[model samples]
Structure formats: structure tokens, C-alpha cells
Target chain A: MKKKILCVCLISVIYSLVFSACTKDVDFNQINDFEVSPVVESSLIFLNEPANKFYNNGVELTTFQDSVAIKIFKDKFIKDHLVKAELVFETSNSIDRGFNLRVDFLTDTNTLQHTFNFSVPASPTNSVLIYNYTEVFEGNELLSLLATEKLLFTLNLQPGEAINESTLGSIQLKSKGIFYLNIDNTL
Target chain B: MKKYLGFILYLACVIGFSQNKQILYGFSEIPQSLLQNPGGKVDNNWYFGIPLFSHIHANAGASGVSTYDLFADDGVDFNSKLESIVYDLKPNDFFTINQQHEIFSGGFAYGPSYNKNEYISFGLYQELDAIVYFPKDYAVLVYEGNQNNINRPFSLDHLNGVAELISVLHVGYNKKVNERFTFGVRGKIYSSIINLRSLNNNGTFITKPGDNNVYDHIFDLDLSLETSGLVNLTEKTDFEPNDLTKQILLGGNLGLGVDLGFTHQIDKQWYLDGSLLDIGFIRHSKNIESYELKGDYIFEGINPFFPEVGSGQTADEYWTEIEEEFEDLFTIDTVKTKYTTLRPIKLNASINYAFGEKLDKECDCTSEDSEYLNRVGLQLYAIKRPRLPQVALTAYYYRRLFNGLNIKATYTLDSYSFSNIGLGMSAQLGGLNFYIMADNFLEYNNIYDAQSVSLQLGFNYIFN
Candidate 1:
């Protein structure tokens, strides 16, 4: 009877071990649809420069001395990635004026540069007018600009023939950029 | 970005390969096998585990893609490889890591007339399990940005997973009521040291061309993250090893569970067995913290004309206003709440045919004629998950090589791999027993391409 009991016990133990060992079946492809939160956002402000220059007929507003140079440090989104930069130009004018706006991007030693030009329409009333221009920087152009720490933007506004001395308007050229950044959370 | 990628690579190195241990299933007469099914036909008078050296198991795996698929030196640039991974991945792909160790476990049985026909056993063990499914939609949106997938809503339902670490103390009872039937039941007390879970999340992200601006981005999110004992660690600047050790032992949360198993012998050759394990829940109340994000927000780009530029407003002030507007749109609520988490329950069933000569008796026992030297069997296993139950089927052969040696081999079919092969060996020297088991043997040579791999080994001293 003792021998029979021991044999049963041994068999029971072995069978149970077999069962436990065989039961762990993991399917890596069994999961679908997961969550990620808070996408990254990166922005660079260029010409939030304060200026009160009144423009007359054929008068040009130069931003050389009043131009702002902002330092953009290296970040995960700013390195080796394409940036969709949307530049917005804001001007507060008191009278109807046809103005020419010229923006220049100056890099290392002020040698490397890129330029963008826009024509602003005269407003019927004295109010702040906003103009938006979007450009995508990728490949060599993006890499070259990202390599430099400091970015300088020179804004020049020329009042067109629509404005005269009596209908003069004060223009403050403000430019800011918005870039959407991707945050990698694979970790 | 490099640091994040490096961390993922490091995780793969530490916990990336794992497979089911089909080889050890019914390989030999080891004492620990009783943990799998208390009603199994094997029983010893007493057994002592070799402290921390006994019963160490570790496994890690990825489902849809392997490391080589992304990082191999195939001349293709890194960007293309990443693009393929993000775009070509299936919705069901996932990554998981699991580990269990017997800190110190030993069990003894007492029964009628020393036959141990009806017996009681007990032991203790610690376990850690973690799993995270790959969110393909979110990956693509983050990798390429919403510029390409504009107007297409990306669902956030895929974000769900759990990570837990706990210690279990259990006591079991086995009874032989008739000539052909044996039944066992185990009651367990689970002391949970850490728990982190995020499940049932729902949200969507969409971007469309704006009428007033270049693009309009919208986010509809409802998500929550819950934690227990480890919540305090988030406030700490640095973590000390000793602090974690204390939590793992008896820090905070607790729960109860049970295991049931039975074996029925058919005539002289056939046997049937079934078991259900870890049917329980953990009540998390200590140091509890839950964070929830539940709202919708739309951003139509920024206006440089805001505050009228030279109206005595600094750039910092302008940007701060934008930040405040965003904060008000999608606010995160943090609260302390007690919650309960159910354990991932497991079920197993098997059938066995015993044959061949009676094995040599290593100890002085009364019933020597009842031992079988060889056996063949088929087993089915399943574990409950948040989405569905994971299942696997296995076929195995067990043989006693000699008086003190035994071996088992198995072939398994499961979700991760179709050709999973396993092997297990057990050797008894005097009264000391040592066993080692591994699965997915074919993938060991080229692990970078294999989806899963696992290993388990242990030592114990048993007496008849």
C-alpha cells in the first residue's frame, strides 16, 4: 500500500510539472491599438522687435539695427528632422498703405542666408494686419540652418505709393514662426 | 531621440527573448511540478528547495517584428527602415517581459499510514510580469507627423497594458478519493509591492486644412494611469535599491487567490488532468495616484499679431498666453484613488498515455509496480488578457533515461512562433534533484530574427 501511494504521488508531481511548463504561451501579435499622449510642439520667435517708425511715400523701414536674433538650442525635434516653419508678419498701421516687406535669414558669420519677400495690402481703417507665409525646410537646407545656434532675421518694410505724409502710418514689423515637432516614445 | 532609442535597445538586450517551456511539461518526477497541478500522479514525502538557487525563470519577446528588421546593416538607410517599421506594422504587435524567482520554497506532505494518499503542501515565490502593445497608428503619427495623415483620425484605443510585481504565499491540499480520481486545491495570499496599469483608453487625433490658418489640429483624448506602492517613487529624485527591496517583501497592497486541479486515470493507460490558477485580484490603496486626461482641443496655429506687437507686451508674455490657452484646453486631473486589479488568470488541460517498462526505484517504497518509465501527452494552455485570451497547444514525449536521469521534448504551436521546440532534463544525484528547461531552441542560433525565447532552471532535494 505504501509503495502504491508513493508511486501515485510521484506520477502526480510529474504530470503537474508538465502541465505548468506547457501552459505559458505568449503571442506578441495579440495586441492591437495602443495610446500615446502629448505630441511635441516647438516654436521659434524671430521679429517680436518693438518699433515705432512712421512710414511716408517711398519711405523704407529697415530692421537692421532693430532686428532680433534668437538662439535655438539643439533638441530632439530640431536635430536631423524636417521642420515646417510658418512665419507670420504682424503690422499696426494708422492709415491705408501699400507696404513691401523683405525678410532675410542670416546664419553663421552672416555669410549663409535665405530671403523671403511679401507685399502687404493697405487696410481701410487703422488696425493691426497679420500676414502668414509657410515654408518647409528639409534635406540640406534644414540641416545647414539647424547646425547654427543663433538665427538672425532682418525685416525691411517699404511703404508703397498708396501712403503720403498726411496719411502716414506707424508700422511695427513682428515675425514669429511655428513648427510642429514629433516626439519619439518608443522607449 | 538617440537616448530613447538606446533605452529601447537596452530593454531588448535585457528582456527581449522568451518562449513557453513546453519541454519541462511532465518531463520528470520533480517536486516543483506539483505547483503546476497538485492532482498530478507524482508525490514525494518531503522536499526542500535550494533557497534562491531554486526555480529561476525569465522571458522576453516581441510579436510582429524583430530587432534585425529595424537595425540590421542591410545598406538601407535608417530613415527607410524606420518608415517601414512604422507603416508596415500590424495592429496586434506587442512586446512583453516576465520573470519569476523562488526566494526560498520548500514543502512536506503528511498522510494516512505514511502513504501520503491525502496530503498538504506549502511554498512561497515572487513574480514580475509586464507587457506593452505597440501602438502603430500613434507611431506613424509621431514619426511622420500629422502632415501626411491629415483628415484621417488616428484612434487611441490601442494604449493599454499592465506591469506588476508581487510575492505569493500558498498552501495546498491533495486528496485521493477513489482508485482513479485525485483532486487538489491551493489557497494563495498575494502581497503586491508594485502595480502600474493603463487600460481602456479612448481618443483620436486629426488635422485638417484650416480656413483661416494653414492647418488645424484637433485632439480628443481620454486616458488614465494608475499606480500603487511605487507611486511614491515618482517624487524621488533618485531611487535606492534597498527601498525597492523593502516594497517587494511586504510594502503595501494585498490580495487573495486560489488554484484548483484534478487528475483522472482511465483504465490502465490513459490519464486526464486540468487546472485553473491565479483567479484573484489585488486591492491597491496605499500611496495610490491616478492621472487622467479627458477633453478635446483644437489649435488653429498661432497669431503673431496677438497683443498688437508693440503694445507694451513682451514675447514671453505673448507666448505665455498661448501656453495658458493650451493648458486650459486639455487639462490633466490627478487624484488619489483606491482601485482593484484582477490577476491574469491561467488555465491548463492535458491528456497522457503511459507505457514502457517500470522505472527503477531509487528509494525504498511499497508500490514499485506502479511506476511508468515513459509517457506521451498533449497539453492545452490559455491565459486571460485585456483584449482576449492567449492560447497555446503542445505535444510532448517523456522518458526516463536511467535510474536517476529523465528527459522530455516538446513541440508547441502558439501566436509568436509556429515552430517552437523545447527540451528539458532532470537528474537526481543521491537525494538532490536538478532540472533545466528551455523553449524555442531553434531560434537560439539566430536570436535576432526569432520572436521569442525562454529559460527555467531549479534545484531541490526530494525524499520518497
Candidate 2:
């Protein structure tokens, strides 16, 4: 009886030893290096303007400027995690006039923080001609973008073409921004 | 996402669950078997368990992934593996744990005639039960973002889980009705220490091409997260550390429950038994706190400022108005109303055919020849869960080595794995009874690879 009891105890001890080695070689500290980079896209601008809107009482307008309030940079989480951003501007011109477009980031008080300019060439036909432009923000530019609270868009008519109140067709601009974020839990 | 790793690991490793007590369900030699099936056979006329050491049980299981799948020191990059896991997440995947510690237990028989006697048993135990189903859509939205998932709605329905800690005080009555059938019932009183429930949520967030802008984001939400006994834990008073212990000892939100079971003898060799446990509910009235959010909104980019009807209102003014509207539409409301929670009910049934040399070679005409040294049977177990019922089926073989020793082995098939093999042993030495049982013994060599594991052991004193 004593021998049988001791055998049972010995088997239980051995089983406990096996249960202790339940896990294989695992690096729990690997969580320290874990990071997630998620890309988020949002609409930025959409403009569908008839040529008549570009004229003030039959006078051709050269400088068409507008500003939209943007408060994303005000968020500390967004400012810290955002690694880079790409602004995609797609333009369809049927106005027979080329235009230089300037997009700027402004502080809450309207102070200019960063600026990027591109050109939309004339369609040269009755049909709409589409042009694509992409601006990537990183490093100093990314930092500048994160310090602003507004978007200022300036569209200037080029010297080659002119439009009046009776002008036909329209100038269309559609844009979006794709933001890349690298979030670290430790931070 | 990285923050979920620690909690998930705790559920998969530190905690345990034993809804499928295949080895202990019909092990009549062990007194605790009565907890699983009250009508379970009893070998002793009376039994008493050692305090704290009577019955210690724990079982842990995860349906989809194991700890080694994420933390193994393989050549794969950790971030890449995490991304793959998030991509493969399923709503049906879940991790559950059930752990119990016995305080004191004892049972006795009483009657004028030995053949017509009935048994009464009682015990008190503290328990912790938790289950968390993988929220696949929520994880995907946070991991990969909605940029690549246009028009796809991220479901809040996947966010369903509950965890509770409580104490159970129970008394059971077992009676053999004639020679063919035995019926038993156990009444339970529950004292809740802590509870958290997040279930039956409905909401969705979708992104699509906007009529005016490049994209529009829409939100439709109806969600609630309820909790109890947490506020009592955080607030420090003169009671201090003793509060937790007090709650564990029945000084907390109380509830009532019952367990019903029966055993039938079909013939000399065939027998059947079944049990229904925890058919009760708990009313959480004290320290109750809950939060609910219900609203819907659509967001397209700020409309371009047109001077046609402007009262000289700046674009900033318009943006502020939209921001305030968004905030008003998504406000979270806190509720302090009391609520009720139904205990996770469990069902167990088995049919066994006994054949081999009988322990009692000579039986009188009035005695039922039930002493078979060998028995083989198939057992079915199921537990109610938030999303779906969890089920496990096991085939087992039992052998009584001698008058004082018994052993049982089992093979089980469940959602976790098909290779679950278990073993149990009980020994009676000079009126002292001891037993040890464990499932997934086949994975003992590579435990980290196993998706689920369970264990139960106890020591008791008996008198015939």
C-alpha cells in the first residue's frame, strides 16, 4: 500500500513538471517592437464652377482664393502618430485657360505655415481634359502641416486665356488626402 | 492593438475554464462528481473534504489561436505575424476561463433502512468565469483603416464579452427511487464580487464615394457596456483590502440558482445519466454602472463656400457648427440602473455499457448487480454562450483496478482540437480519498501549441 501511494505521488510530480513546460520558446518582449501603420484617406476639396462664376459683372477674375477650416492638427494624437500624408488633386479643365493653383496650410490665426503650388493646363478643346497632381508631405513639411488649422486654396488664371460672364463650360477640381500613421503603444 | 496582447495572454494562460468536465462527470469514486451530476453514484456512506484543498479546478481554452502562434521564436517577424493574425480574425473565435477554489465541503446519508436511504451534500466555493469573443471587424478597422475598405461596414456586433467573479453556496439532495432510477437536485446561492458585460451591441461605420466630395463617412451606432462591483473595488475606505475578501465570502450582490439531474439503469449492463447545471440568474443592484451610446450621422467634406447666399459668414463659423453637431450626435449616456444576468447554463449527458468481471461475484436476488469492473461510454457536454453554444463530445473507458483504485481515460472532439486526450485517477487508502484529472494530456509535451487545457484535483475523507 505504501509503495502504490508513493508511485502515484511520483507520477503526479512528473505530470506537474510536464505542465510547467506548456509553452515553447516565446519572446514576450517582442511586443515592445510592435507598431501599426494605418493609412487613412479623407476628402479635401471638390469644386465645380461654371465659367460665369469666374467673372464679376463681365470682368474676368484672375485670383480666385478660398479657405476651409481644418482642425485635425489640433489633436495631439493625430500630430504625434501621423508619419506622412499625400494630397491628390485631380482637375478637369474645359475653360480653355491654364491656371496656377497654390494650396497653403494656415494656423488658427491665419498665419501661413506651409505652401505647395502646381499648374493645371488648359483643355484646348470643347471636351474636358483631366490633369493629376500629387504632393507628398514628410520631415519638415510634415511637421509644418501638423502645425496648421486651415487650408487656403488660390487659383490664378494664366495669361494665355481669358473668360467673361458669357464664357461656356466650367473649371472643376476634386481632391483628397491619404494620411499615413505609425502608432506605437509605448509612446 | 499591442495592448490587447497582455489581456489575451492572461485569458489564454493564467485563467482556466472547465465546462467540459469529461473525466469528472461520471467518476463516482470522487465526491465532487456530484457537483457535475447530482445523481452520480456514491461509493461512501459519508464523506468530508479538507478545507481549501478539497477541490481546485481550472480550464482555459481559445477557439482560433494559441499563445505560441503569436509569441513563438520562429524566424517570422512579429509585426508581420500580428498583421496576419488580425487579417484572419473571425467573429466566432473566443477565449474563455473558469476557475474555482473550494472552501469546505461534506456529505452524509440518513434513513431508517439502508436500501431506502437518501444522501445530502453541501459546499461553498469561489469562482471566476470570463469569455471574450474576437471582434474581427473592429480590429480590422483599427489595423488596416477604412481606406481600402470602401462601402464595407465595420460591425459593432462582434464586440461581445463578459467576465464575472462570484461565490456559490449549495446543498444537494440525492435519492434512489426504487432500483431503476435515481434523481437529485442542488440549490445554489450566488454572491457576486465583480461583473462586466458587453453584449448585444449594434452599430456600423462605412465609407463610400460622396455625392459632392471624394468620400463620405457614415456612422450608425447603438451600443452599451455595463459593469458592476467595479466601483466598489476602486473606492478606498476604512474597509480597505478586506472588502474584496468580504465580497468573495457572500457579502455582495446576491442571487439564486438550482441544478437538476437524474440517472437511469436500463438493465444489468446499460445505464444512462444526465444533468442541467446553473439554471439561474443574478440581480446586480449595488455598485451598478453602465454606459450607452445611440446615434447616427453622415459626414461629407465641408461644403465649398459659395458667395450666392452668404451673410458674410466665414468658413470657420460653418466648420464650428458642424463640429458641434457631430459632438451632439455621438454623446455617450451613463446609466446607473440595476440589471440582471443569467448564469451560463451547462448540460451534461452520458450513456455507458458496463461489461467485465463483476466486483460482487455473488449477488442476492434483491440486490442490483451494478458492480462492473469495466465500462465504456460516450458523453456530450454543452454550455450557453453569447454568440453560439459551445459543445464538446468525448468517448471514455473506465476501469476499476481494485477495491481501492480506479482510473478513467478519454478522447474528446471540440471546437479547439480533435486530439484532446485526458486521464483521471482516484485512490482510496484507509478512508482517505484523493484524485487528479486533466484534459489535453496529448499536448503536454508541447503545451504552448495546444489551444485548450483543463485540470481538477481534490482530497477527501470518507466513512462507510
- Supply candidate 1's per-residue lDDT for B61: 76
DockQ of each: 0.07, 0.50
Instruction: Please give, for every candidate in the order listed, the TM-score of chain B alone compared with the true chain B.
Output: 0.87, 0.91
In the range B1-464, model 1's lDDT, one tens digit per residue, is 99998954543322222224456544537776767776665656777889887788888777767766665555555556667777776655678788889877777666667456776777778988888877878777676556457688888877878888898888888888787998989898888888888887898978765543445667788888888866567776576888767665666588999988889988677889888888898899887888898878776543333334357664445556655667765687888989999988877789999887663357544354566768899987777766556677788888775667777878877667677787777878888999887777666555666677677889998886
Candidate 2 is graded, for docking, as medium
Alpha-carbon RMSD, each predicted model: 10.6, 6.1
Per-model TM against the reference = 0.72, 0.89
Displacement of the residue A157 alpha carbon in candidate 1, Å: 13
Question: lDDT values of the candidates?
Answer: 0.66, 0.83
Per-residue lDDT value at B390 in model 1: 65
